[model samples]
Structures are given as C-alpha cells and as structure tokens.
Target: MSTRTIQTSAYGGMNRKLRFNGKMKSREIIEWLREAKQERYYTILKFDEVILNSAIIAEVLDLLRISSRHGRVWERVSLEFCEGPVDLVVSSLVLMDCVRHLFLASDKIQDDLMDRLSTALRISTSLKSLWLLIPMTEVSATHLGSAMKYNRSIDKLSLSGSNWENSDDSDSDSDDDTNDGSKSLRPKLFGKQNAGNSPVENQMSPRDAAMSLALGLKYNDGIQSLDISCCDLPDEAMAPIIDGLVGHPYLEALNISRNRCRIQSVEALGRVVEDDDCLIRSLDLREQSPHDALEISPLSFALRQNRSLEALRISHNELVDSQVLELVDSFRGNASIKELDLEHNNITEKGIPDLTKYIKELPSLTKLLLGGNAIGEEGFNFLESLEDDDDSICTITEEDLRPAKPRSTKTAKTSKSTAAAAVSNNVSFLTGIAE
Candidate 1:
C-alpha cells in the first residue's frame, strides 16, 4: 500500500512526516507535536546526521511543553542520534520544560556541544535520560563526570556499544571448507581523534574516564542505572570503579559488559557484593571475561553469599556444561536471584538437568533465558518441562538449540565457507570494548 494510503487509514489523513532541507524547522516540529498531542499518539524526530541548531531544538522543546499543557504529545519524546554527527550545542537545553530521551553518539559530538552538555547536565532539571556512545574525548568525559556530581534528575546513563551493528546489505554466497579457525577480538573503540589533538584530548582512556565517573558516583544520587558496555577499560580503571560502586546509594543497575573485565577484577566486585549494604541488584556481566572456567568460580561463589542480587545476565562468555553446572550450584537453594539470563553460552542438553535441579531447590526461580545454545527439539521440550508453565523459556530459541546438519548442497557449503573466510580476513576491523 502507498504511504499516503497507510497514513489515511492509520491517522485519518494526517501528515506527520517532516521533510527537512538545511535545518529542522521549529514550526514544522511544533505542528507535529500539536497533532500528535491532540491524537494522543507518540512523537519521534529521527535525524540522519543532520545539523541540529540549538535555536530550533529550544523552540521545538518549548512549543512541545506548551502542547503538552494543552493536551498534546506523550510525557517524553525520543531524539536519537545514530552514527555520530558533527554536532553543535549552543547551551544546555536543561532549562527546557519538556522531558526528552536524548541519544548522542560520542564520536560525533563536537567541542562546543560538550560544553553545552556539561552546562545542561549541571543545571537542566528536564534531562530525563542520556546515552553517550563511546569514543568521547577526555575533556568531554571529565565534563560528564562534573555534570553528574550532584545532579539527581537523570535516571539512566548508557554508553553500551556492542560489536556487529545492524547491517542491511545482502551477503555474498561463499564458503570455507577448511577447519582453520581463529578467535576475533572484541569491538575496538570507534573513531580516531583529529590531527594535532593532545593525547588526553585524542580519546578519553576508559580508565581515566572511569575514574571521573567514580568521582561522580561518589556524589551521584539521581542516576540509578549505568551501562558502560563495549567501553574499553583496563584493570587499573575497572578496579577503582568496582571499589567506588560498593556502597553507592542510588545505583541499582550496572552493565559492565565487554569491558575486558577479568576474573580477578570481577572477584574484587564479587567480594563487595557479598556485603549486605550494597544496593545494586540487577547486574549484566555478559562477556566480561575471556575464560569461561575462570569466570564461573569467583562470581558464583559471590552470588551464593550475597543477599541483595535478584537478576543476573551472564551471556556470550563461552560457558560449557561444567561451568554452567558450577553456576547452577551457586544458585541452588539461594535466597535471591529469581531471573537468570544464560544466552549465547556454549551449553548443551547434558547440562539441562543440572540447571533444572535448582528449579525445585529454589522456589523463586521465575524466568530463564537460554537462547544461542545447541539444544535440539528434545532439549527444548525438556527445558519447557522444568517449570510448571512454559512462560519462563521466553528467550529460548529452538533453532539455536538444534544440532548442526551436514551440508545438503555444494553451493551451500561453498557459501558458508566463503562467509567464514570473509569474516576471518576482516576480523581485525571488528570493534569491541577492548582496543
């Protein structure tokens, strides 16, 4: 169907799409906000690296607040900036009346923008959520740290940049027949500093940025959740952050995924988690350590002793049956941790029964996510039989669990091998939390 036809049927013939030329017009945005407000619908403005004029943003935001007062738009509007932009921030929009979820690519943010952001974070009471994609400069990081020092408005601060972004291009049919294999390193930090910039100005070392964040966390009260996924942090930086997070009053959720966090550093955090005073409950330690066997013992031992943790995600760390058994043993008869996420692990059917044993031992087991495993139909059925209802296996995928079949055609085999070779050749380019 045509877009106009779809809109006519969906919105009673209302025009919501905005066509921008050089700049995003405030008048156009104001009208969109008004229409969306009157209809009680959502309002979203997605820009493709377009230049965002502070005047336009401020005017639209002010108009949006008025529209909400007159019964238009939802409580929050989404402004997402994909693939960093050469941005300019005149002043912090913190004084703006409307609530907005802002996503800014760290690599794309310019110098002036950082200053404005710091100003906004320092004073703006309207900034609800902020997402800073990695590769921001040290100055920007320090400014961010200063902004979050005492401010209590922001609830979520995310810097998670996972490898393998969403791709739309079609794949070429090629295959690799050889058994030659190699492990690809995690995604590296994005973007390079402009020429002539100082070392600290080039890109903020995760360690120094983390130290600044630790300073902010010491005084932070409003932000309750923090995500630093794919942000490279050496042991020196990781250790301090763990030490700082021990008794943080407001921080309840922490995502340290893909930070090159080793078993030793995690052990330090685990020791703190054993404390009854720690407030953090929801934790995502997915792909933190390189060695699965090393990761199992320390964190599991900590979980067994902790009393506050309720939800844990530990996916993509190459967990085998034995390691999973050790983890399950830690959770067995535990008082906390009702939800467990074991996605992207190397688990198989042999470990299912051991994991299931905890279902009866601990009455609080509510949800279990087991996708990206090698479980077949029987394995899926067996897992479904664990709990009284099948609702707990929401993340389980039967296709991922099924056993691999022999190639039925030469062409198919060739294509598979070719893709593997392509990945192998370009593996060095793939970015991760560690450079």
Candidate 2:
C-alpha cells in the first residue's frame, strides 16, 4: 500500500540490531537500505497478500540482488514470494546469504525452483527458520534432510500442506508389505548407491525423504522444533522419524499429527516416550487412533517413567472406558503433565470413578478434555463434581495452581486476644472446682 508504512526501532541483545516490519515498494526498500548504516537489521518487507507476477518479482529481486552484490547485508530478513516468476525467486536468494527467515507458499511450484531452494539451504548457515507450505514433494524433504548434515543454525522447519499426491501414481493408503512379505511396497530408502551415481539420480520417495531427514537428524543437534504435520508420509516413512527421536536431547516440540501412521510405526513412538534420553516436552499424536489399549500400552507404560512430557494430545483415538481407566491409572505418580487431551474417545460414565480417583491423587493435572464422545450427561456431571469437590487433592493447575495468601498481622493479634479470654474463663471454672 503506502511507501511511508515503515516502522523502525532499536532492539538490544548480544547483537543490538535495528528491526523494522511493514509493506514498502522496491524503491522504498532501496531508500531504507541507503539511509541505514547498521550491519545487522531485521526487516520484514513485503506487500500484504499481494499476488505478484514475474515482472514485479524480478524487479524486487533485482533490487535485493543488486544491493547484496554491492556488499549490503540484511542480517535477519523475512521474505515471502507472494506470486513470483518461479525462475527469478531462486536466483534472487542464491548469494543473499544474510536472508535467514523464509516463508514460501504457492499453488503450483516448479522442480528446478525446489532444487535451487534446497541448494540454497545447503549453504544457509545463517538461516534459522524456514517454512515451505508449497508442494515441493520429496525435493524439500531430501534437501532438509541433507541440510541437517551441513548447516548448524537452521533449526525451525515447517513442511506443512504437503500432500503426498505429488505424483500421478502416488497413493499413501497402500499396505506396508508386498505379497511375499520380503519387500516393502514403498520404495526402499538409500539402497547401496552406484559407485559413480548419486541419491539424486533417482527422485527420492516420500519414504526416502523422511528417512533421509531422520537419518541426518541422528547426528544433528541443531534442530529443536520440527513440525512435519499433514506431510503425506506413509507408515514406512513415519518409522525413521520415530527412530530419530531416540537420542535427541534438545528436541522439545514434535508434532506428527494427521500423518496416518500404522501400529508398527507408533510402536517406535512408544519407545521414544519410554526412553529417558529424549527431551521432547510437547507431543501431538492426534488422529492416529490406535484400535485398543494394547496399541497404546507402550506409551501408557512409558508415562510411569516419563517426567518431561507436559502436554499430550491423543484425541480422536476412540479409547474405551477401560482404556481411559488404564490411562488415568498410569498417571498415578506422574505430576509433570499439565494438559491431557482425551477428546473424541469412548470415555463414558463407567470410567468416571477411576478418572476421579486419579484426578484427585495425581497432584499435577490441570485440564482434562473429554469432549466428542457419547460420554452422556452422567460423565459430564462427574466432571462437574470434580470441579466442586474440595477434597480433590490434585488437579494442581485447575483450582489451586498458586499457594494461599499469608495471614495478616492484625488477624493474628485478634486470635491471640480471643485465646486469652477463653483461657481466663477456663481458669475461673477451675478455681471454683478447687474451692
């Protein structure tokens, strides 16, 4: 909109950089760069939801490209290609190493562009955050996997809106095993590479991409927050991600929701929760419903030992009343969990007794979500009772998250006077008895 819409201020940290965010034209951007003499600048410069064409994109990129080639640096700039000439966007960022935060989204994306972005990430040691909501298929996945090997600073990654239907023949609903059970239906990941060839010669499958990412994660310690939600990964691909959770200490948030994982793949998650080595605090396994408690047994058992998990979402898993009872029972000694989402399960009034028992005893539970089931009016009444019941010891975050206020000195003086008067009356009665 307005070329005068720029906001600027000084930010203090180890690196005291000037930060600015707003929409501006290419000419305005050039003006700001020319006026500013600082080496470190955090600029979020772009139009709001503007669907730009190739010419506009080229003009903007040309400005940025020319500035960078002339030794100008944008320390932490956030760039989003609204609608650009696919060809220019890649080249626009090639030597712009100062560009760290990136957000790319498009209806239709080209392969070479995807390859170029991957290549850029290989050298983006300054890149700390990247969100590719566009359909890059295996290209983004493999490059991201490979980046973990080289880049040390790029930690936050979001590959959301990835539909595995990147291929005309791609079907994620296929079974894990072939007819003889000796081979996997999905393409094998990283088979012994031919001596002179490379892994890129064959386009990486979704499974291979996942494995490559996870394999790189095994040796990596930089990535902490990973959101691979809705990235059409098959059951086989889901395995490496689970296995990658084995030894990572800095990984605090992991969301694998809506990936449609199988029992075998989820068993790996069980191992991760059970292992004391992994430091994941927030886990989202929603929509990957396990049929019975047996499917959830590993995590149920792991809960007894896990002290780091704070929020767990197992909603839409169709858990029976017995399963709910088992889940509550497993949380007996656990005090770290603040939110337990059991929404869309089969929990009913029959399981309310066990639920109430642990709700009072567990000492750390705050919010218990039990919506979306036929749990009936009776189950809700049970929850209502939990809220009103003063005897409930736990539910730490619910009613008694903070300590009681201290008694006033004036009240203490009043209590002392009242106690003296009662003692004097008692002495009179004792004196009469003595007489």
Candidate 3:
C-alpha cells in the first residue's frame, strides 16, 4: 500500500514547505519522515525550539540516513534548539551530502559537538553557506579552522554570537596570559564577561579562538562574506584575524562591528585594505571601544592608496574634527568609494568645510551619512552651501544631517544670523536644524 503524503503548511520559498515550531509529537514526525518518498518536494526545513527525545533522534537519523543513501538531499535547513541532544541532531545534518545551506543556532551546544561538526565540515563538498550562532570554545574554533583548511564550498560564514557567554563559565577569563603585563591587549571583552556563573569544562578564550580562526582563514580561499559581529573580540584577538585576511583573493565583505577592538586591531585591518591584491568592497568598524582614542590615520592612508573599497562604516568610533579632516582629505583622488557612514561621531563645524569640499569633488560619493553628530549652525551652513547648487550630484538626506544633541543656548544665539542666512539660500536644506 502506498504511504500517505505529508502536506506541510509552512512556506518560506518555492521549495520550503516544512516547518516545525516548539514541541512536536515524535510518532507523527517519525511517521511523516519514514513515509516520505524519494521525490521529496520539500527542500527547506526549519525547527525552532523543539523539545527533543530519543525517538526524535532516532527518527531524524533514519530520515537522514535514508536521504544520504539516495544521494544528495535537501537545499537549506535551519535548526534553533532550546534544549535536548543538539550534538546528535546537528552532526547528522552536517554530514548530509549536497545540503547547500545549513544554519544552527543554540546555546546548549558543547565542545564535543563542535568538534564533531568541525570534522563533518572537513569532508563536506556541497554545503555553501554556514551560520553557527552557538557559543564556541577555543578548542572548537581550532577544530573549525582545521576543517576550513580542507573545505572550499562554503563562501558565506557567520559566527555571530559564537563566543557568547556560557552560563556554566560566564565570569572566568579565558586568556590569563593576555593580562600578565600588556596594557594594549584587554583581558576580556567589556559587557560580555562576568564572574559569577558555575565553572564549565573547556571554556572558550576569545584570543585563542580568534588566532585559530585567523590561521584557518589564511588557508581557506573560498570564503567571501564573513560576519563575526558582536563576538566580544578585543584588539589582541581581532588583530590576528585581520592580519590573516590581508592577501585573501576571494574574501570581499567583512563585518567586525560591536567589538572591543582598539587602534592596534584597526591598524591591522588597514593593512588588509592597503594590500595591492585586496578585493574587499565593504568594511564595517562601527561601535569600537569608545573609551580609547583611536588614531584613524592608518585607515586614511589605506583609503588613499586602495581603489577597490566602495562602502565604509566608521560610525561610533569617536572621530573628531582632525580625524574627519584627515579622512576627507584622503578621498580627494580615490573614486571607488560610493558611500560613507560617519554617523554618531564627534565631527563638528571645524571639519564640515573640508567634508563638503570633498563630497563636491567626488561625484562618485552619493551618500554621506553624518547623523548623530553635534554639527553646529555654522557646520549646518557648510552643508547648506552645497544644496544651493541644484546640479550637484550628491544629496545628503535630512536624516543624515540631524544633530546628536541639543544646541547650547549661547552657541544657538551666536550663530542665529548665519543659520538664518543659510536657511534663506536653501529653504529645503534641513530647515530649522540645530545641534
């Protein structure tokens, strides 16, 4: 007798027809998988916070085993586990041949599971995109790097929150040697580590994990887009990773935002952009450590020399007038840049003239984001001057011109006449704007 056909209700794409959320009956899921035909119509499957047990594990294994034997199966699969045997479930999925994309997000994953997943990645030939949002250990990162050395199919890798704090080992510093005497290298990422949780086995160290990832990436040639944002990476740890990506041929987009990186790490990233073979088109360096005054000359130097980068985000880096001037001056001859984000920086009227001049000269720069800065009335006048020329190619949005804070009454009154004059020239250019 022919088995009953499973008609899934969820739809994410043309082939995405299966979706399981929260708890599911083991027998029903098992029956559905067992009865599934060779001509499986569903290619995408997602499981969110599903409770797990032995029957679920056995059923999943049976389905994967059958699908594997039938050759490559499945296109994309995502699993967000809240509890239960994550290692077993994830490992089985990783080993599946011809699974094009795999995303696993969980906080319960342990080192042994990460090791298994890394081993599976080493021999896989079909997976192309991998997103592991699980908490990671240094040993796990080392294994992952080793796996990346042999794997060439994956081009997009996101390890966002991979190094997030584990409940079992939250407050402990993973790298004690970093704090021995060096003032430059931070012992741990701020707001990311606290010392109250129960100790866990084989805890992750950010420095060692970053070093291992760098070593692995140095050999991997297929990765193009990489995201390690919000990983709580410090300068000492982040620098080596930047160093590894210096001469990468295929790597293009990199996001290292919201880290504890200081100037040392920034300089290393500058070297990567300065490389003659660098193909990086977009770079993000936002929300770095605000307490430290980072010198941005290295990035300016690299920008002046490099021609491949198009989009740059250095917002929330506490750039003052001098640094902003330096950055604008570097854009004089370089034409590849199309968008720049200087939002939430410390730029004021002192640097607006140079910025206006540069934006005018570089017609290629179409978007200039300056929001969240205290550009006073005079600085607003500088931007208004550009708006007077109706033929100008660049257009700064009103949002881009908004000030970060309220203007002081003294300064507001002092520049009242200048502001009025600027408004008269261009009534539509950020009218009634104040810092």
In model 3, how large is the Cα lDDT of residue 317?
72
Quote the positional error of residue 205 for candidate 1 in Å.
Answer: 1.8
Q: Which candidate tops lDDT? A: 3
What is the C-alpha lDDT profile of model 3 across 210-329, one tens digit per residue? Answer: 898889998988899887765657688888988989889898888886667877887998899889989998887776755454678888887788888888877767788888888877
Ranking by TM-score: 3, 1, 2
Q: Write the per-residue lDDT of candidate 1 for residues 1-435, one digit (tens) a residue.
A: 964454346434343332222343455534444554445344333343344455455544555566547634323332333222233322323444344555544333344566566776777666666765534555566777788885678887765541112111233233223222423234443333333433333444656766776776667777778776555465677666677666676777887766667765677677667766677778877665544433657777877777777888887678888888787787777777777888878889877776666555766767778888886666677776664543553458422211121211111211223222222322222211011
Residue-wise lDDT of candidate 2 within 1-435, one digit each (tens)? Answer: 443442332233333343322344545445554444333343433333344555456555765666566665443343332434543554366447655555543334345666566667666655676655444446656665666766667677665434333232223233243233432111111112223422333554767667767876776677777776544466788878778777676777777755557766677877887787868788877655434332576667667777778888777566787777776777788878777777767777788767877777667877777666675677666766677545432232222101211211111111222222222322311121111
lDDT of each: 0.55, 0.54, 0.66
Model 2 residue 336 distance off true place after TM-score fit, in angstroms: 1.5
Poorest 10 consecutive residues of model 3 by lDDT? 405-414
lDDT of 2 at 176: 47
Please list the residue runs of candidate 2 whose C-alpha ends up more than 4 Å from where it truly belongs after superposition.
1-42, 47-95, 166-204, 290-294, 388-435
lDDT of 2: 0.54
TM-score of 3: 0.78
Would you estimate the TM-scores of all the predictions? 0.67, 0.66, 0.78
